[model samples]
Structure formats: structure tokens, C-alpha cells
Target: MVIRGAGRLTAAAVGVAVTVATAVGLVLTPSSAKVEPAMVADPGPPEVTISIALGGATHGYVNPDVALAQGGTLTIANGDGVLHTVTSDALGTSGDPLFGFSVPARTTRSFALPSLAGGAYGFYCVFHPGMRGTLTVIGGPVGEVPAPPSFDQALRIPKVLSGDHITIPMKKADVRIMADGPKTTMWTYGGSYPGPTIERRAGQQTKVTFVHKLPKDAGSMTVHHHGGHQSSADDGQPTKHLIEKGAKRTYTYALRDAGKPAPAAFNFYHDHRMHVTARNNWRGLQGMFLITDPKEKKLGLPTGKYDVPLHFSDRSFTASNQLSDPFGHAAHSGHGGMPGWMTGEHAPPNDATVGQRILVNGQYAPYLTVKPGLYRLRLLNASLFSAYDFALSDGSAFTQVGTGSGLLPAPVTRQDVLLGPAQRADVVVDFRGKAGQDVLLSTIPRSDSTGTGSRNAALMQFRVRGTTSQKARVPGKLRPLAPLKGVPGKVSKTWTFDLSEMHSGGQHGSFWSINGKMFKASRMDHKVRMNSVEKWKLRNTSDMTHYVHLHQEQWHTLSRDGDEPPPWEQGLEDTWRLDPGEEVVVAARFTDFPGVFMLHCHMLDHEDHGMMAQFEIVR
Candidate 1:
């Protein structure tokens, strides 16, 4: 069993009873550690159950954290106050198949591993990066599984916008996508990986119905429409409402009366399933959701074919060409300051999954054939764990036109722009005179890794082709931004992001905290009035990095620490990353959404572990 996400902790003692029992002809020794068997009146199946105690800085295994049973069910119970996942491919080794189960708060869950010829299996929380254990399967033949086919998609994936009212069916379909090799299987939506881009205009009421036609075992899914202010039901908060396999749900994004209309910006829709988000998204369950305004569109910017939405992500592939979790199966990258958690003894304080290869719009080092003119590129750093500092190979300057929120005050010429996970930027690249130049889109080293600029540097290539008659313009002023001073509510809350450790209960791992508390879904961390704007002070107390994200509202940065925010952050934004010990002040207003919303780290693994918290929006 695998548990994901963060929450409270617990402690318990394993029973000392010594009863040697046999189930399905498999010998079992009574464990010195505490554990419970199935509560069925009659022994239903050959199974071994492990009780997990989760609490402050601790994830305790009641048993030896190893097993000798063969071909049976493995049960795990979460006796904690938050959601968790038990992912068997915790080390992400190629020999082990990825299997996960969500152990909800204070609940027990089980999974069957019937064809188990195993040696040692490592399991960990998809959420808690540092919490892991090993389970040894003895008396079974150990062998390797067959490798998957190579995955290489040679075409440039385009961004598509859904119609005004569209019905999107979510089902398990195999898609052929290649990044650098042959075709590989991709779990997809509507038969396409990354699904299909859904585009909408501000003030337009769009109703989208998601039909879950996935296989019975594909697990539940929910599409979180980030950067939209609608309602709690439509917000797609994790662990709240999910579309079970064969089930369906409709979300209405009624921005018709969202109060003076938030800025039109680049948003995205991705799977936010409880406990299995990292795997789900890594398996190709994400897409672009762009919001546009007519006035901004009429500014004669790069439109139509010239306007490109580039989704950048990094991925690791197994020898068989299957998508593998870098967190698991990967060699511990000791780059930057990452805690070599893969092989190290203790959990690293905070770690991010950095991939070995980069993908641009689902293509590996793809070349974009562009005319000698200006093109508007909507850049999204969709990498699950990596942050990037993007620049041209030739070091030419590009103008940043917009941010994740919307249009900037003016275009800022920059030689390089840093993008953290889940962050977006709109850039204007001019290729008029550089027609024959093959410019490489390179990335700088991330905060978590050492300078890998030479290894996985270039993301994509821009092949300047024939000439085009299209003209693009960058206006001096894009739009008017709201003043932070007169925004409504007072300074309502302050959240501190930090690291905590649990040294007792026979458990040890580094965990993330907000205001010194781990994330608890059942607990509402804060509350706010609807339609009232409030200022939030976010302080990063940890010695690592965190990208703070708030759902439903596109807020404005009031200031960073004590000084004013830079031009890039002064617009409508949904996410921001803070360096260690850095403090930032941002303001947001609750509109029609009146329910529980989330404010958490966007470094998905961290959020899954414990760096996430929620607040209530009341009427």
C-alpha cells in the first residue's frame, strides 16, 4: 500500500503475541512489530497487513517493514490525521512495477500482488519524499520484467481550445508519443497525451463536462482548473470531489460576474487526484487552458499560427521506454543541494524531482520552423520538479510580454528568464534578420541542482525558415493593474514555509510545514470573507525553495520582503516561488467561490508530502 500527501502523525506499539500462522500454505512468523490482520470472520485471502502510524515528523512502521509472504494482498492502514499514499515503486527501480494505494486519513487500504516473484521492494509516499521503507519478499524467484517500447513523437503538438460548451471524455486510451525515441504508450485524455488545450475568453460562461471512461483500475481523477475563480465544486481541490472510473462531472467556469474580471492569462488543467497526482500527471494527464481578452488580442500581438503555447517539462524513461518517476527509479542526483534521498540514510530536508531530459511541447529538442518575423510564445514550465532559467544559445535578448497572470506593464528585455515549477511567462521573440540561424532554447541550472547547463541545457531549437508577412507589436502599456493599497481587506494572514524533523517513535524523515503545522485536509488552516480582498504575507523559513500557489484567485504581489516587487510579479499571478528565508506579501480577493480552497507549495512532491494547507472562504 502507498500513501501520498501530508498530514498529522501518530505512534503505536506492535503486539508481542507470538503466533505462527499459515495462510494459503505460506508460512508466517508473528511480527514483533505491531500489525493487524484482516477483520473478516473467516480468513478470506492470504494477506499480510501493516499498520502505519503517522505524526509529527514521523512515519512509523509497526512491523519489520519487510515481508516474506508470497502471492497475497498487502494491507496498510493510515492511523494519522491526513491523507497518504503507499507507492510500491518508491525507489522507482526498473524491475518493480509501479503500484499505489491511497490510505485515507484514519483508514486502512489493501492491494493484491499475486504474481509476486520479488527480492526487495521499496515503497514511499508519493507525497512525502523523505518517508520510505523496504519490503523484502523472500522464497520467490526474482526476475526482471519486459521492457516497454521506445517512445518518440516526431510532430509538434499544437494547443487547441475547446468550444464554448464542450464535453471531454476521460478514459484509458493508449497514445503514441515520442520525445526522442520510438513510439511509446501514453495514458491519455480523448486519445491524446497532454489531452487537448482548452481555450476560453474572459466573461464567457463555459461549461465543461468530464466523462470518466477509464479502466476500472485506472483510479479516480479530477481536473483542477487553475487560475479561475468560480466555486469550490468547480475548483477541483484534491481529495474533495473526484470522477470515479465510468463516472462523470461537469465544472462551470462562470466568469461572467467575477468582479471587474481578473486578467486574462495562461492557465492549465491537470489531474489532481488524491495521493497519485505526481504519477497521474507524469503519465500525461495535463493540458493548457488559456484565457484571453478581446482588447488584448486586438493589440496586434502575435496571433493565429504565430502565437505558440510552449509547455516545457522534463521526464525520465525506463529502458523499455515507459515513463518512470524520477523520484523513484532514478539514481540519486547529488546535484545542487538535493539530499541524496535515493541512497542517503535520512530524508533530505526538501527535494525536487529533476529530470534528465527536457521536453518542449511534447517534443524532445524539437525544431520550430518559424518565418523571419516576431512570434509570441506563451511559455509554461510544466516540469513536475525542475525550475529553469531559459535563454537563447546565442545569448540574444527577448522581450517578456506577459506573465502567468496576464500582460505586463511593458515588455522587459531579458537575456534569460527564470521559471519555477507551474510558473508561466509570455515572451516575444524576433526572428526577422536571423532567418538562417538555428537558435537553441537553452536552460540554466536550477536552484536545487548544480550547473547542469551543459548536460541537459537546450530545451528546443528554433529553425528560422521562410519569410512571413505577419507583423507583431509590443505596446508600451498592456493594461492597468489594480493598486495594492486600496484593495479591500486588511492583512489577514501570514504563512511560514519551513522544514521539520521527527526524531522519535522509531521513525525519522524530514517534513514540510506551514506555520509549523503539516498539512491536514480535515483541518481548515484559515478563513476569509467572500468578495473581500486580503493581504497575505508568505515567509519561507526553510533553507530550501518553495513555490507558493493559491487556488481560485489571481493575486497581485504587494511587495517582496520590505521592498517593492519586480515588474514581472506586479501583475495578476496565481503562484510565486520564494528563496530560502525570503518573505513576500501578496493580496487576493474571494469572489463567488465560498468553500475550502488550497494554498500550498507548487513543487508537487513537496505539496504531496506536507507543505500544503487550506483555508475556508465564507460568504
Candidate 2:
């Protein structure tokens, strides 16, 4: 048995150039013949001059002011070897053609930007979202960006499994196909529970030696680097053709640094193992993959004594304490939790009540003992369909740390942290009360924590054990993030969606929808160029709050309908719950990697219950 190497990766300063660092065949490699260079002596890519600094030529910012006059030629220099493009959203909102000009390594091309006016233009690497730049065109005063984050040298990171982390194990579950309950099935990574946690440094390498232990019916196990960009092969797409059960495959990949002043505070990983993402993730085949880049680590933010990654989830258990995949046949589940939602293709009485009694990692009602001082609880709502307008029982405040995509430059104290399905919050809760006193955690009012049958509560009792040592204290601030650059004028398009409940068949089919319809291939959501900004609005009509989430991209929560916290909601989030009859707006940009992605409710049941939609992005 050969053990796969969790290799070391260098945080090489990136300007522009894709290095074919290493490639090991996942399953097997065939014999090949070597070829000698026939024409060139020192063969390499056609070299051109490039600006290796962050921004402009690299993944950072361009000079604050645009030097262009009227009808000046715009130059797109490719620092990264992989194919790239310079696109704009000035044409139209939907279906805008991209400026597909290829700049090989070190190459640069000039194009005309007619009638240059003062505005912000977004740029990105066609292959990687992390590689992006901001172009500010100024005929007037330009904008200013905050200073980058400063990292502390003593950030505590468990040396083992810290950077370039990998793990492999038997995937077992009662796989569901369009819902119904428990059947014999195999899973990858996180068995019938949230899978393994793969942690790594910002710039590192990892490879998984995966073996399919499924039945003869299935032979696929793919790992989806949920927050990864650049390398598409590691995206973990399952194919009909796979290594047979009992056979193994090794997947290797590198974590390229996104040259920001700060580090990516949080990211998640899960099984992209193909057609079973819904089933595998639903069957507890899910876990968190964290990246602690060196830059952020150096930030003197709260260390191990305060920071903790808390996964939140909710599950319904039977009298026997067995978790039944009630999300099967979600079509039969009520607007809340209904029966026949977890099982695959099985039917049951649609009126059955589904109450989630257990909170696993990110679940409801999980207990955690804390000290009587300030403790930063990194809460991740990894639930299938639960959202928390979370607040402390005594009405304590939570100093928010970060969102889905990354962290902000400063901390914002929040009264209630609202997390839709898949949404997360880095909150610093000060346990300043008496030690040994019991603290009760509860969900905020708007969250409707009470379930359909009664009140829904995601809280658990937290008993303070002791006081913290003075040597360890929460930092004045957490990791700072790259300043949010400006976007072009209203050149972007508009997108709208509606969420509501429906009644179908003889039973009350509990589900919501976008744009008043379910996901249909024939129906196009919206199309846009590679780099552009657009305003998206989600109108909720259902009685329950549906947290809508987007993948592969990060969006900023602009504002809610009321005086509710909008600035606090500005963290990078993949999931956000829409309270009943409330409308939320998001300022978003669709960067490189032209493809179609799914946008669904964070509530797994709501998503499987037909509350899902898809959008397309093109170059």
C-alpha cells in the first residue's frame, strides 16, 4: 500500500504566469513517448513585458487614477500563463459579449476605450476568480482604499493538517435520488456525518488517495474544493467512468495565494463527486476545509484562545435517536419540515411533521462551554434548511469577524447574526458574566426560531467553565480584508427573484421558488460578462425565511427592507435567509470562469423541495 504525500507548497509571489507545477494521473497514467525540441533552443512561452505588482498586470489593483484620456487604448497584460480576458459590462445587462483578447504569458494588448469617463472597471483572470484587479478610470477625483491588514507572527495553527491538507475515508449513506429515506449507500469524505476537516496554509499542496468502497452500483468519489479556483480538474466532477469499487485514485492540487494584503479568513470544501452532491452532502457527507494563509495568521487578531470554527446544522431524530433523512422526497415536505423529504424516491404520508431535534456541527441545540471572557465563536450555518437570527439569551452583542468569501477590514458588532443555510459568521461573544453561570443562547425574533408546530430554537446551554489567562487576549481587531473596489456605472444588468409556497397534489407541498417558477433548463436566469457588477433583489413571499445562497462567487448584502442590520450583513455569504415578506439586495460581480451555477435555499429541504434556480456567466 503506497501512502500519498501531503506535499509542501511554496507561496511564490505571483505576478502573471501559470506553472504546471505537478501533475499525477488521478487513476492511472498510460505510457508516453518523449519529444525533443526541434525548432527553438531554449523553448518556453513567447515572453512579453509585464507589471508584476498587485493590481493591473497581477491580481491586485491598478493605480488609483486612470491615465486614459478620451479614446485611449486599454492594455490587458497577461501575467498568469493561463488564458485570460479583459471584459466590461458597459454593453448591456444580459448577454453582453466579452472582449476575448488573449494575452499569453508576458504579452500585452491595447484596446480602445471610447470617451473615457470617471468610473471603476473590474478585471479578473478568466480561469481564476481569486486572481482579479480593479481599474479606476478618473476624469474627476478618484477613490481611496484602506490600508491592507497586518498579521501577527504568533497565530496558533495546528502544524499537522494545517496547510495543503487532505483526508480520505469510506463514504457510506442511504443515498437519495430526488428524495424519499434510508437505503444502503456509500459516501466519500464525511460518512453519514459532516466529513473530515481538511485544513491547510494559504500556499500549500494537497492530494487525496481516494478508494471507492461503494456497492457494485456506484464507483465514484470526488472531492470538490468548494472555495478553490484556478485548477478546474480538481473541481471534483464525477463521471460515469470511474475507478471500480475497492479501487483507488489520487487527486493532487495546489492552493495558489490570492495576493491580498489579508488572508482568506474562511472557506469550505465538500464532495463534488458528481451527480451525488445533493445526496452525498445531504447524507452527512460534508465538512469544512479551512485555509489559514500566512498573511492573515500574522494579523494579531484573536488567536486559539478566542477563535473557534463552529459548524452549525440541524437534524430530526426519532425516538430511537436515529436521524432519518426526512428531506427525501422534499416535494412532500411542508413549507416547514415535512415528511418524505430525505428518502430517495420513497413516498409517505405528506402530513407527517418533521422536527429537527438535534444540532450537529452547525446544527441546532449543540452545547459548547465557554469562559467568562470574550470568546470569538466562528459560527457556520451548514444546515440543510435552518436559518438563525441568533442572539444571546441575555441580549449580548456579537462582534462579527467575517462572511462567506472572507473578512472585512474592521469588526462590526451585531445585535442578531442572521445566517441562512450555508451562511457563516465570525462573532466575538464576550462572556463577561459570572463564571460557572449558565448562559442560554437563542435565535433572534425575525428568524422565527419557533418551528411550524411551535417555536424553533437553535440554542444550546453554554456553561462558563473558568476565566481566561491574562496572557491570552482577544486582539483589538481581526484579519483585515482587501478593500472593496468600485464597479462601473449602472452598465450592469438587473436580476429579480420571488420566493413563495405552493400547494400541489392531494397534500400540502411545502416549497418556495425564484422568479415565481422552479428550476427549468429551458428558463434562463440571467447572463452577464466575465467582470461586471449587478444589483440582485430577492423578494420573499413565503411564511418561512429562505436563505438563498450562491456558489463560486461572493456577494455583498446591501440592505434589508427595514432598519435591520444591512452593514453587518456585508460579509461574504453564500447563504442568506429571507424573512417572510422581506426583500434583500446584494451588490455582486461575476468574475472569471464562465459557467453555470446553482442558487438555492440554504435549507437543504427547501432546496430539494424545489426551491432552487440556476444562473449562467459567460465571457
Candidate 3:
């Protein structure tokens, strides 16, 4: 039993209990936790029995269609010919996989769901999306439900990169992080704390002669390309190999100059190692990959006179020690997050009160003075897992120009927008101002981590400083992005991910996993042909929402977040996010990878907590 995402602190306890029981073939019961008293409130309607079927021919049933109490429980039955797992992201349901009952075919399995409040919950099968069901808690005031994340109109802060002639020393330099500080090692690049930022255009290959720079280095780290193409050996993955301290290793990968034609939108580089990434990135070793295109330059979009690179993130730290990862929740990270953070009901705080630092391009409370004309922002969400909904301090609309697929066919003006764990949006904000007026650029507070809802807090601040020209105007159209042709009729092979589980303790913490397995460092699951296009249909059957991510391939979303494929998604990609209960159909052409690649949860903790698996691309 593994809980998929337990926002509740019950994750640690639950995980420990299940692991022991599995090994002994007996359930280990722990004393129920003492409950804190809550002032009473209005009751919700009785739940109706909603019968759902899993595995087309194999159907499982869940009774009591809806759960209305804050921490109520529901009983589910397994009636399918095959085994079934029931999981949710309700309050205490961390990404544990034990809450699930693995009833054999023809037998019945029962599961008791513990407490789920009034908001909508996401549930899915780790086996198949075709095997999905939803439990909508009704009887609440309409507005109480969070509004879906919107592209509400707002102003855009100008964008800028370290626009520099980047040079990775031809010779490898041994380096180490200085942890002998008041707190943990402040982040560093190359060798020194806060490793130097590298800036370059697309179509350029960065040659890195990597050398283990740490003394007694027991762990490994790699430079990950945050862009779409992640297949080449250059894409970071410790398992691929390691460069030892004092020994030099060269890694030369090309970056298509955005100023010319390119393979991806602007991207960034960061370390993706487990456990250590959160600490390293928070300390400031993250940098941007600025890709410019002649097509974009010709668009008459906001140019240098008004561009800004606003890297937004939320972090919590004390004057000396950065607050440790919340016992279970992952605030701003993709790896080593506890399963508890993914499925729990603990909504993230909206203000930066508990958190002490905010950096924009590596500087605290970064102040970038802007000109009054139209300012284009190359916004980056470099935080580990914190998501945001943003708008101008004063209500204003911002023109959206590009996203995962690059500049839309035209400039799209939207209100508030959703920036998920690793998603980005390029916008143009026109500041109609006196030369030195201050305009604060910020994001809203957010609550539910599963869906695009809730405004967590103000993500950043931008001040309008320089003079403006009345001559600036936002064109109705920016660039033309056509969708790629699909390989629909060719359904070579199909796979489904039914997210079910609430398991506890093992070597890794309890977590939500596909089938009944967590991510094992040495396991390889799927073997495929490189360059073969296939369809993967994903469905979320758990109460909590899971962000499913794939490595070595950035696939296209067939349908999701109300986005239908325009002419662009027809090509290939390396990542696609799947929301709960929502089915996303995607096609990918894996042209590389002689060995296995990984396809798992984007929620890093869930991946580390055993919510991951491997896929091999062979001959």
C-alpha cells in the first residue's frame, strides 16, 4: 500500500507501517493519531455510490460517489478480473501505495479512504486511464471551489539573460562547494559558490571538461538541459557515467542559436541529482539557456530596449540555515520530495512570510529597471515544485507570445496564467509610463497542487525605470507556429498509467507507484525501438493529481488543459504533464537511446519515493 500524494503529515507513519506488513504478510496497526479539534461547520450531502471500472475487461467498484467531510473515509471494492489499486490526493493520502488493496481476479478487495474535504479530488489507475473515475464533492457554495487557472490578462516584465560570451574553460577545473558557512553550502557553479552563469545563443555547443570538484566526493551530479531535447548523452543522468575529481571529461553539446533557427525555446541548466539538487539549486547554481531566433527578432516583438529574463521561485530559509524540506512537502523542487507532499491536503502558504529569500537571475529581490514601451519577459519557473498564477500589481493584461511550443501563431493576450513545476510562458507587457515609474511584476497565491488552481503568492517584483516611447505597440500577431502532422492511424504499441497506491516504508519512503512497484535504481521496464512513434494514453485515478514526466523524450499533448494541438505539437517533445482524471493522448518518436530511459512522475519526490520506472529504447 502506498499513498500517491499525502499532503497530510501521516505519510511517514503510514509508509513505515505498510512496508513491515508486506514483508510479514500481516498488517501492522499503529495507534491512531490524536486529532486536533476543529470548530464545527455545515455538513455536506451523503455520498452516492459511483461504480467505476478499471482495465477495460476488468472492472473495480468504488462506492459512496463523494466524500464531504474534511477527513472522512470511503470503502472501495475490487471487482475486476485483474488486481486494482485505489488512491487519492485527499488530505492525508500522501503518495503512499499501500492504502490500495491488491485483490486477485474474481476476488474482492476493500480499501478505507481516510478523510477528504469539500474541494474536488483527482483519482486514477496506475494501469490505465480507460480505467478512471471521479468523486466530485457537492453541496458547497459555488465560489468556494477554486477557479480554474486562467490566462487572465496582465502586464509582462521585460526579459534579459546574462547576455555574455560564455566560455567553459577548455581545461577541467577541480572544485568543491564551501559548506563551512553559517548555513548549508551556498550554491556554486564550476567550483566557487554560485557557479558562474553561462550565456549563449542557440545552435552553439557548450564544451564542458567536467571534473569531480568535491573532496571525498561520494555522490554524482550532471548538467541537465532544461530544453526539449534530452536524448543525447549530454543530457544529465548520473547513471550514464561520472567524471571523477582531478580527472577531466569533456561534454560538447550543441545549442541551436535561437537568434537563428532552433530545436527548442529558450531553456536553462540545473543539477537533477536526488537529495542534493534542492539544496544546490536553492543556493543559486541554476542558470538560463537563452535561445534567440531571427524569426522572433523580425516579429517586432519587444527587443533589447525592453526585454527581461525573470526567473521566479519560492524558497524558505532562516537567516543562516535554509528551512529543511518540510517533513513531507516539497515547496520548490522536482526531486527527493516526499510522497506526502504530492497527495496531502496541506495547501501551500500564499505569502512569502515563512520563506526568507527571493532571487531573480541569482540576486535577492532583484531590481531590473524597465523602459516604458513594450517589454518582453522570458519568464522561467526555476523552483523545484512551487507553481504560480501571476498578474500586475495593478490589474492589467499581458500579451502571451510563446510557450512549450514556442511563439504562438500570434500574440495572445491573457489574464492570469498557470506556470506548473517546469512550465514557462513568454509575455509582452507594455508599460505606459513616465521614464522612471515603478511597476511591480508579481504572481498570485496558489492552493491545490494537483490542478491549476489557487493563487499561492506574489512570485516576483519588477520596477519600471527607464523612459518610454509612445511609438510602441503590441502587434496582434507575433510568430506563426504550425502543429506537426500526427501518426494517429499508426498505433504500434500502447501503454497506460493508472496511478493507484498509498504504500508505506521500504528503502525509499512510501509513495504512489504504477502497478505495485516503486522506482528501483537498477530496474528497466519498457524496451522500444529508437525513432519509433507510439501512443501513450495516461489517466489519473488517484484522489491527488500527479504530474507524469518522461525523460529522453518530450512528447506532445494530444488534448489537455483545454489545449488542442495546433499545427505545432505535431513534431516531437521531451516532456508532457498529465493532470488527474484527465486523459492525454500523446505520440513520440524516439530516435536515440540504446539503453533504457525513464518515464515517471514530474513530482520529483514521487519519482524518488518510488513513483518512477524505466523504459528502454533498443534496436
Between candidates 1 and 3, the lDDT winner:
1
Ranking by TM-score: 1, 3, 2
Query: Tens-digit lDDT track for model 1 on 12-61?
Result: 10111111110100001111111222122332336777666755114345
Residue ranges of candidate 2 with Cα displaced over 4 Å: 1-160, 163-165, 173-192, 205-211, 215-262, 271-279, 297-299, 327-355, 362-371, 444-455, 472-486, 491-495, 499-512, 520-524, 541-543, 562-565
Error of 1 at 154 (Å): 5.6
Better of 1 and 2 by TM-score: 1
List, residue by residue over 1-619, the lDDT tens digit for candidate 2. Answer: 0001011111111111111110010100011111111232222222222232322223422332233433345555544322333333121111111111223333455554433234454433222223344444434322221111111121112222443434465556542211113332435353534555666665566775566666665445555555554233444544322445687766664555333222354656555443244555544556666766565555555666566676655443322333444323333433324344422222111112112232435233345667777666766666543345676766677877677567765678778776655666776777776588766555532422311111124245667787776333345565443334665444243333443344445444323466667555456577766666676666676534456666555566666764544555656655665654677766666654566666666454445445566666777
The stretch of ten residues in a row with the least summed lDDT in candidate 2 is: 1-10
Considering every candidate listed, which one attains the maximal lDDT? 1
The TM-score measured for candidate 3 stands at 0.61
TM-score of each: 0.71, 0.58, 0.61
Instruction: Tell me how far the alpha carbon of residue 122 in candidate 3 is from the true structure, in angstroms, after superposition.
Output: 26
Q: Each model's C-alpha lDDT?
A: 0.63, 0.46, 0.45
- The global Cα lDDT (0 to 1) of model 1 is 0.63
